[model samples]
Target chain A: MRRILSSVTDGRGFDILLVSITMIFLLALSGMPLVYNVVMSFQEVDMFNLNTFSRPYAGLENYREVVSQPEFGLILKNTAFFVFGSIAGQFVLGFALAMFFMMRFPFAATIRGVFLVSWVMPGLVVGALWGWILAGDFGVLNAILKGIGVIDSTMFWKSDPRLSIWAVTIANIWLGLAFNMMLLSVGLAAIPRDLYEAAELDGANGWHRFTTMTLPMMRSTIGAVLALGLIYTLQQFDLFPAITEGGPANSSNVAQYWAWQYSFLLFDFAKGATVSVMMLGFVLIASIVYVWSTRHEVRG
Target chain B: MTPQIEIASVDKHYGAYHALKDINLTIPRGAFTALVGPSGCGKSTLLRSIAGLESITSGNLRIAGTEMSGVPPRKRDVAMVFQSYALYPHMNVLGNLTYSLRFKGFNKEQARKKADEVAQVIGLTELLERYPRELSGGQRQRVAMGRAIICEPKAFLFDEPLSNLDAALRVHMRMEIRALHDRLGATSVYVTHDQVEAMTMADHVVVMRAGVIEQQGAPLELYDNPANKFVAGFIGSPAMNFLDATVAEDGRSARLEIAGKPVLPLARTLQPGREVTVGLRPEHLRIDTAAPRLQVPVRVVESTGSLTYSTTETEPELMIVEQGRGRYRAGETLPLTIAPEDIHLFDPTSGTAL
Candidate 1:
């Protein structure tokens, strides 16, 4: 008893004790589920076999079925569009906004904080809000487009096959724009002000300074923002279920939503697990990139 | 010598606070000028104005006899060495030195050739490809200087460039910078709060306080004949000591207000019975019992083998510095004397020379 008490208070015993507690909690909660899903993707899972660990080994059969579906091609294209479109929109607009707010003006911080309102909202709530704004008949966006004479007729955004994926992508961009801008702003602020003055005295114009000094100094930050954006966009599930529901013949369906549809809506648990395991590959790569980029920060 | 940079009635204001007021200075070509002052005294603001980093609210500035009214910092053609060194951490030393040259449309080969020449001049030829984070503080300082030198601008503005280094490095870099200025025959304006650096490095020194130029002249000229008490106290180590006194019956002398009321002759005549402030440099004082001009109890004694520093135990304690170690202990009354010509009298109310 005395040894137990002493071990808890000092030496490697305390370190081992702390590590074991967290390790046990993570293994029981996250690690088991993750391993179970990967195992389920390799087996023939059904409602009858859900309760038991042992299942019939299906091998590559589940992966084959998921890839061979008729809507698979369209969903793959839509997923690529949503991921790249959302990330590109968020990053470009976020960087521009971050640079704009860097000027010395009153209410700058307060106004930038106001920009985070859309991001502060939950994804499902933001999707619902954008759903109304992107509605076919009574949408405010179509009304603005008509009022500005950009379009002569009402345009169906969420229901139209061509525009269904774009509606959700736009809403996701709005949701993540503030996150990107805030992260990039912190990166921009970490740079010393005297560097700009020194560059100015060195005969660098605005464009030259931006390219030579600002861009290179923000390498790690841009990497982190891009890597996280990739992961976040991949895991983006709430918006799909809220706005388009992978509607109009799967034109808006993405990897995460399709995985959910195969598991709960269609009751094809193996195919859902198979689809998610594939996405895990991309997220793992992004995580590695994030860690590596941050480890190599160029700050002096 | 012809003036290289000229400022006429310059003033700077940030909203309601005035930073620099009616400052006029002419920096002659190839002359090294030092702006020395306390913090927030507009010395840095003045230097930045010259660099075009900070815009002057009113007045004309001429560099190389050209008007600089609307010229941006990049177009002003002046290089500044910041106190932080501000080397680009992302770039290697070679990249840093050649960045401005590249902007000026230097081809890759031309830029590399120029970088080589600058690296050789700055003693960083060995570390050309090393990033700033990999270099030590002194090496980074040399990179900043090299970056400034490669451009060969109209003038160089240094904002306390050596303030970040250790004491020994600060002194060594001080001489190296002065030597570089002399060898290049480049016009330079250095700003520092350390008067010793300004005295030793600059041929001309401008002392400023409260947004006003208190005095400007040769380093020793300002040291020997300060226009005001502020300049007098600011321009020397250990600082000049001030004591309140009443002029004696004779207009040429004044009696000290300490315990002994010891009397000393003034350098210049003052009205008899006038209240004046006596300014005596600490180094000018000595222990002279035979001709005792001051009798005060010592408060503290410090010895550094080559010098003795003592403070008197009085309301406004006076500091006395003497060459070499002389026995001095706390609570001991010490008699001191000063030559009549070494005495400085000031008008007590205005803090100006009498």
Candidate 2:
């Protein structure tokens, strides 16, 4: 007993003790739910035996049913649009802002710090805030666009089928922009200032320096940022409920919102788990990319 | 031939701080000039201004007879080897060497061939595919030099490039850099705070202090005939020993304020009874017990196998460096003498050579 106690206090046993605690937490909450969901997807999970783990085996039936839904094709397209659209918009704007703040001007750090307000805000709150800005009639965005003569008629963002998915994507871009900028700014700051000076003396102008030095140095950071952004964009759910609620006849329904709709709104637990399992594959790929890109993070 | 670079009446200011003051310099073609001073003395600032990295507040700059005022660093076409080496961490050695050629419109194959030639010259042919993080410090320094020489710009600027290496490597690289400059016949402007480095490497040395050019001339000219007391004190190692003195009534001899007011004969005539400061080089002072000049007790002795450096116990201590092992012990009075021409005199108030 004393040997065990002493080992736990200050030895390899202490390391094992700390690791097992985190393992138990992860297994009980995350591992168990994932296994149960995967198992439930392969079984007949109807309202009759909803509370039981054992059920009549229905291998591939739920998968086929989920894939055969009439809205499957549209949801798949909308999810693709939302994911790629949000990632592109956020990354471009975020990288631009990161470079802008790197200039030597007064209040650069203070203003960059204020950009974190968008990051700290809850997703639902940001969605509501963007909802008002993207509203059909009194929205500031539409007013400005009309004022600039880009449009004569109002852009009915959340209500129209063509713009419903786009509304959530725009909100997500605003919500994710600050986080992307912060990570990119850290990467930019990690680059030595002398590199730019040396390049300039080596007969390189601004654009050449950027293409040759800045972009190549930022490769790993950009990879990690894009991968994390993909995983985060796929898991986005609060913006959907707060803005369009995946409405306009399921025009803006992404895979995550569609999975929620399957299990809760329609009470089809099997289809819900099957839809989420498909997303898990994508998230797993993104996780692998994030890990791989960070392999060079410990460089001198 | 016209000078390679000329700065006439240049000045630089950072808000209220005047960094370079009324600087004027001329770099002849193929001359290796060294700008040397203590830290924050504007030597590096002047080097950067010549490279167009920092703009001068008011003055004209010329590079190879072309007016360089308001010109950017890239347009100036002068490459610099930074002290940090600043190799691109992501690129291999060959990529770093060829980056400038690519921007200058060289095709990939042509640039690669040029890189191979330069890499062979710099002895980096074996390390072509190694990233900067994989190379040793000396190899990285060689790559920086290779990058600078590949462009074949108008001139080369080196900002204390060997300061990061260990002592043995620093000495070795110093000779290597000088040899490279000679072989290329490049007009190179080097900056350092070490007076020994400036004296040993540069044919023309410019000494600066507090943003002003204290002196500029050939290394031996500055050493043999320093323009002022600051130059006199700065140009030599174990630094020139200074002592308070006044010219005697005869005007050809001065009384040094060591012990007993010993008289030191002057090389030239001066105003009688004029108060002045005497400068003496350490190596010039010898133990002439046959004809003693000044006597002071020894305070400390340090030996580095070859030479002996000793200090004298005086109000303001005098440091003496002898050629071989010193036989004198501490706390013992030692008689020393210097040659008449080597006894440098300066006006007491102005610190200027008389």
Candidate 3:
């Protein structure tokens, strides 16, 4: 008893205890829900039997019905577009901004710090703000686009079927931009300044230096940023309801928002669990990629 | 022959703090020059300015025969081996050595051949496929040098490149670097704070202090006839000792004010009754009982098998370094003498060689 108590207080046992606590928490909160969702998807679930653990096994019925739904193809396409569009836009713009702020100028750090406001603000707040700016008639974005002669008429972002999905993507890119930039900035700062000087003396110009030094050194950071972006974009739900609500005939409805609709509004619990299980596969792949990239982070 | 690099009236400023004052230097086509000073003496700033890494506030910098003003580092055709080695962690040894050649449009076969040859010279032949992180500190240093020499650059600049190695490796690499410089006959500029490194590795040594060159010449030239008291004090290993003195009425000798009023003979006639500071190298002072010059008691004695270093118990303690093991102990009085030619006199107020 004394040995066990001592170990728990100050030895390897303490480490194990710390780890098990997190494991228990995750199992109770996240792992159990995931297993339950998968189990519920493979069983016949109804509003009357929702409180019970035992259910009739309905192999592939929920999956088949969910996949055969009329709006499934459209929602899947919208999800793909939103994930890729948001990731691409956020990464490119964030990387550009990170590199720009690396230049020596007064208030450069201060201005970069201000860009983090978007990341810290609640998702609903950001969505509302972007919705206002992306409004069809009185929006600042349209006013500027029209003034610059790029648009003959105002863009109806939320109402149009083709543009409704894009409206949510635009807001997501803004919401995630600061996080991508901050991570990239930390990665950029980790590179020793002497490496750039050495490259300069080795006959490498600005462009060559970037390709050879900056890009290669940032490989791990870029991997982590993209993987996290994919997961985060997949999980985005607040902006959907605030802006288009996956609306205008399900044109903008992504898998996550659609799953929520099936469970709550449409009262189809099995289909909701089925759709969520599919998203869990993508998040798992992204998590693996994130771990693999960071494994080789120790530089010379 | 015209110098390979020439800098005339160069000045550097960081906002209001002046870093490099009007500095003029000339590097010959195949000379190995070292810029050596204590920390914050602008030795590094000057070297960076020469490499075009740091822009000079006002100067005419000429490399070979071309004006280097407003020119970037890549176009200057000069290579630098940084103290940090600065090897690309992502690339293997071969890639690092051949990086510049690739930029210069060399094909894979040609670049690989060049890298192999350079690798062989630096004894990195078997480590070609290994990344920088896999190599030891000394190996990384050699790779940095190999990368610098592969391009056949007009000049080589080293910023304390051997400082990161262990003491034994540092000594070995010092001769290796000098040998490489001789074989290539490349014009090189090295920077170091250790005077010994500058003395051993460089053909011409430029000693700097506070953004100004105190002296520049051959190593022995600076040692034998230092231009100022600072150079005299800085050039030697254990440092030269300075004592308060006054020229005697005889005008041929000076009275050293120590424990005993010892009159030491001078190499040159000085102004009568002139106050001066006398400099004596520790190696030159010897314990002489037969012909005692100054009588002082020993405070401490340290022996290192080959030599003895002792300090005298006096108001202004004088250090003495002598060959062979010394049996002297603390509080033991001993007579010391130095040859008249070995005595150096400096102006007390200006610390200049008189």
Candidate 4:
């Protein structure tokens, strides 16, 4: 006992003790739930069986039922569109803003810091704010577009099936932009200034320098940002309820919101767990990419 | 010879602080000029301005007799070797060497051929496929030089390119760079804080202090006849010793303010009873027991195998360097003599040579 106590207080034993504590906490909180969810997807999980860990096995039935649903293909397509659209919008705009703020002007850093407000605000709150802005008739976006002569009629963002998914995607893009910019700014700042100067003296023009120096130096950072963006966009659910509620004939219903609808509204725990387990595969790939890119940082 | 680079009345201001003030310099074609000073003396700033990496606030800059004011660095046709080497980390050795060729619209085959020739010239033939991080410091430095020379730009700018290397490698690279310059007959401007590098590597050395050129001339000329007290102190290692003195009423001899107040004859006449600063190089001061000289107690005696250096016990200590091993010990009194012609006189207040 004394040896264990002393080891916990000093030496490599202490390091192992701390690591094992974290490992145990992660296993109990994250690992156990993931395994349980996967197990629930393979079992007949009704209300009576939900309270118990031991349930009758029904392998692949939940997956087959979930896949055969009329809305399954629509939800999968919406999820793909949401993930790719939100990521593309967030990354390009965020990178441009990061580069803009990198210029040595007064209040550049302070202004860039102010941009973190979007990232810091609760996603539900941002969704609520964007909900009003994206309203069809009285929203600020329609008003601005009307004022700019880009549109003469109301474009129903939430009610119309075609625009409802786009409304949530736009809101999610705004929500994720600040995060992408901050991470990319860190990557940009890591590049030594002398490299640019040397490239300039090497007879590279502005566009050439961007292609040769800035882009190449930011490879790992770009990879991490994109991978994280994919994971974050896939996890997004608050914006859908606030803006579109995945409704208007379920045109905006993505996999995450559909999973919630299955478990809570319809009480189909098996189908919900099955959908979430499928999402785990995508998130797993994204996490691997994030880790690999971050590990491959090319610093001198 | 026509000047390769010419600057007239150049000034640089960073908001309220003046960096380079009213600078004028001319680099003759094929001559290697060194801009050398202590840190923050604008040597690097001047080199950057020459490379068009920095813009002069208000000055006329001409490269090869063409005005370069308001021209971008890409259009300036000059190459620079930065102190950090700045070899593109993502690119291999050949890629780094061929990067500029791509901007010149060279095809892949031509670019690779040029890279091959330059790699051989810099002795990086075997390492063409390796990245910059894989190379050693000396190898990276050679790659930087090769990158600069591959384009055959009109002028080359080096911003303390060898300061990062080990001492032995620095010496080796120094000769390699000089030999490369001679082989190319390229107009080069090198910036360094080390006066030894300036003296040995450059035909013309420009000494700067506080945003102004203190003196610029041939290396031996600056050493033999420094224009000011700062240049004299800065040009030599184990810097020149300065002593307070007052010229005698005869104007031909000066009384040094040491323990005994020894009187030493001057090589040139100066205003009688004027206060002056006596500048004496350590190498110029010698040990002579038979001559009339100042006797002072030795404080420390340090010797390398071929040379010896000793300091005298004075209010402001005096140092002397002699060839061969020193025979003096601490606490021993030794008589030191310097040739009258070797003594440099400066106005005490202005630090300007008289």
Candidate 5:
């Protein structure tokens, strides 16, 4: 009787142990920042009164305040411009590079090796290098422009409100081009050589082959690259912070940078949490739309 | 219409390796010529060169009296069916057939009409609306044929088109292709490693080995009179068996001695005491019990419904094909007889037919 009782206790203990381990793994995975952000977005907490151990609830008040801010509207608009502008430049340049690589040329391998270097570098390092290159005073670009007599005087690149957005966009485009090029190059190579042979037999010249064969065959690849680009560009914060610091009177500030400023720098925890929550919502909506548009391609 | 294709002294090289060497062929118009050889024999390369897919290193290919040295595949007015079918995955069967027509300046209605006509001919009219992935292997094969025929190109090039099908389907498709050729009377150059396909489908067969043409003639001509031992061994099913022998004096006949048994009076006129190889086909050997016969110990026996093949352990291992049920048992000494006229004699040194 005692042995039977002991075995029952041991089985119960084993079940409890398995349940605990599984719960820990799940909390680490899907329960970390996503749930924390949700909980904190509804909590009422001030910067000075912040206690890491405290529990508080505000019930949508933070969300309401965040939406009512005047800067929030401008931040949203700037984010849109940054995402779309960066993605467009990256795709165009990347696609061109991919096409160039596809040609049968000497030193093609060497060129691919050189292009891969930029993508492999840390994003922080890329931002820092571009920041120096785009600096207004004593920068190489301004010096070269002045020396060549293209411009009469040195122009401030980061400080000027009109040019700051363009400078940031240029930096992001350079950093993002490598990704698009590599992916599209793979797509181009995956197409069967026989298709091209067949198309040529069908009387398709260079332009006809490109429009009818190359473009249509690359539809799934293009859709995948564009969708990924949109998502990655939407959450962009590193380049703006490292290079421009959302500076020149906040003219180039994106939503992610704004969220970081409210949460970390300003110590307005409630409002910062609200901003983070809104950014999450925006990302989810964009991803959902992208998936819906490319469902057929994904299935294929 | 006599649409002759002549490839004169054509040579192709890939870097340092010579792919094709001095290949010369004449394919008469409306004749179905098959290039038959093992893989890497440059048969497909030669076919692609004819289709203008690969540029020849030297020499000229003339189709209907026009030199096609610098012509591209599109301007050559020839169509090709690849082994993989190479159908456009995104397009349905109808779209696949009409894709080339659009580039040829045919309007949508006209292209569809032509596609439908070819689809009916290839028995793919019911499958026009289905995608390539949705169709079975045989259906996709028919669609590929439809795509090639819809353009009505001057010549058709097939690179092992029926290789991907099952054995039964391959046989069925082979007959379909033959029927299609009869109806269209299109000049075609087909490449395959299967000797049966070459013998059955080709009006003329070109046997190749090591980047050179061993022999080229009508199928029956090659079977009856192979120029060399290589052609003789490669052109027949169950392959011709060769035995070492020496010619008898007076140059009238050859004597082949196998397993201490004298099988003499082989019909050949060679110098006396000259070494030679005697060739025999399995079907020519008959199992006889009446008169004096060449005795052979049977090694293995395979019985099909129509014929029985028995392998014998002689000087050169021989395969014997007999009609109907064969009463010969394994491990038994069987008496076999060969007709005097059915013998093929070859020179021992040069391996050429005497």
Candidate 6:
């Protein structure tokens, strides 16, 4: 009896030690950035001054000053257009492509393999390639347009302030398409063939089956894709910097680039952290709404 | 209304593998025809082909005198109850039943009215507003049936609709399906591997083997006179027992010699000295003390509440189903008798009845 009790205690001790180690690793992973961000956003700091590690709270002044900037509203609007436009475009095109590939067609596997290349390519590489392609002079697009006699001469594609947002939006759409397509494709494949057969027997044609069966079955995947797309697009900085650099006259400046400008370019870390915190808040609220609306679809 | 579904020399292939071969069958109007076979026997494939879920490689199919060869499943006017129930997870029970009707051009009011009628018939009126996830397995099955029945299509296709339920629920649902068929009198094609379900619910059972029809007949006809040994073995529970035998000099009756001791008589005509297989159902074997037909040593004894099963090993292993009680112990020799009328003889080379 004593031996058995001791062995049981030994087993429980190992379990407790394992749980403690896991909790320590989790705290190191999740708690570090949260604590750093909270501290930096609340403190008055600058790039030139190294006081972020030891600064005191400035009581929402940083947030107030950040919001009082002239370009804040414009940046917010550009961020909204970039995120919403890119996500919407990716979803529509990606879902359509996914459905197309889902059908029984020849060389579908080869086509899918080709489509996946864009997703596996690095974001920097994609931005650089699009940057060269959208260049005003000696660009393939302008050359084609001129060759087709659609335009008299090469136009300033990325330099024009009016078309800069669209230029950035197009690049982001291309980058995100393959991700959405792969996710929605897996979701579509998981649906049983019997459901489609049953629906067909129930007087549902191809369109009806897609709307009722495919759409509902892919709801959770759509939600995940949309949420991730929204979050990534809202925090987008790499592609814009490489492609347009938030020009002409900051027409394509998103929240993340604006925040980077404040911190690194303008040397106001407090205001940049303030912008970051605000963007994070918006993302959290949007995510919460997305999760709440899609709760039933997820469970079902 | 007479139900009429006909398939003429339908052929279907998947790459090099022939999933279905030169299949021809006619399900009479208002008849419940069951496609019964083991898994991968193309029973479901045949049902799907009839439902137009699968395209036929060749030949013609018709329902209600209209060609169904190129028609889609929806236009074929047939409703299928999938094995998984396939209830729309997002929709409530009422929504599931009414969703298809809207596409069929039924107005919202008419669809709702039809859904209500179906709900009442299936005893799912209370669960109509609830979602599929909220319902039990049996309730979901009823909802699936209700979804199919609400369409009032020309024929109903049931693809192992009750296989998901537990044994007790399956039995209950089987009876319910039979009653539903009797009342609706719909031309139904049901696919199931379980012979009991086919035997109980089907007006005609089409036994398929390797994508070909082995036999097609009424349940009792198939039981009483099997066309082949596969049907004989497949139809009954505990399965029919087979032993090597030779035709006697009389030609009409054959001698089934077991363990070189007990020789049983089978009522079938065969060439004398010809090797044949003798089949006997477990229920036909009885425990006799005085006039024992065949004796064998008991191997295993299983006692259920109603009936007892004693598995015996003679020259060939056999299962003996007896009523009430079994006094035989393991390794104990017991006398087993089968009535000559119940005996079945099949050609050893080809599994065909003599």
Q: Tell me which residue pairs clash in candidate 3.
A: none
- Model 1 ranges off by over 4 Å: A1-7
Among incorrect, acceptable, medium and high, the docking class of model 5 is: medium
- How would the docking of model 3 be graded? high
Higher-scoring candidate on lDDT, 2 or 5:
2
Instruction: Show the lowest summed lDDT stretch of 10 residues, model 3 chain B.
Output: B327-336
Give candidate 2 misplaced runs (Cα > 4 Å). Answer: A1-11, B258-260
* Comparing 1 and 6 on DockQ, the stronger one: 1
Query: How far is A32's C-alpha from truth in model 6 (Å)?
Result: 6.6
Per-model i-RMS in Å? Answer: 0.9, 1.3, 0.7, 1.0, 2.0, 1.4
What's the TM for model 6? 0.90
* Deviation of model 4 at A13, angstroms: 1.6
Better of 3 and 4 by DockQ: 3
- Model 4 DockQ reads 0.82
DockQ of 3: 0.85
True contacts kept of 3: 0.86
lDDT by residue (B264-347, candidate 3, tens digit) is: 999889889999999999999988989988888999999998989999887688889999988678888878899999999999
lDDT values, one for every candidate = 0.92, 0.93, 0.93, 0.92, 0.85, 0.86
Interface RMSD of 4: 1.0
Candidate 4 residue pairs that clash? none
Error of 2 at A59 (Å): 1.4
Instruction: Give lDDT tens digits, candidate 5, residues A181-225.
Output: 998898899888888888888778888888887888888778778
Candidate DockQ scores, in order = 0.82, 0.70, 0.85, 0.82, 0.55, 0.66
lDDT of 3: 0.93
CAPRI-style quality class for the chain A–B interface of candidate 2: medium
Per-residue error for B292 in candidate 2, Å, reads 1.7
- Ranked by DockQ, top first: 3, 4, 1, 2, 6, 5
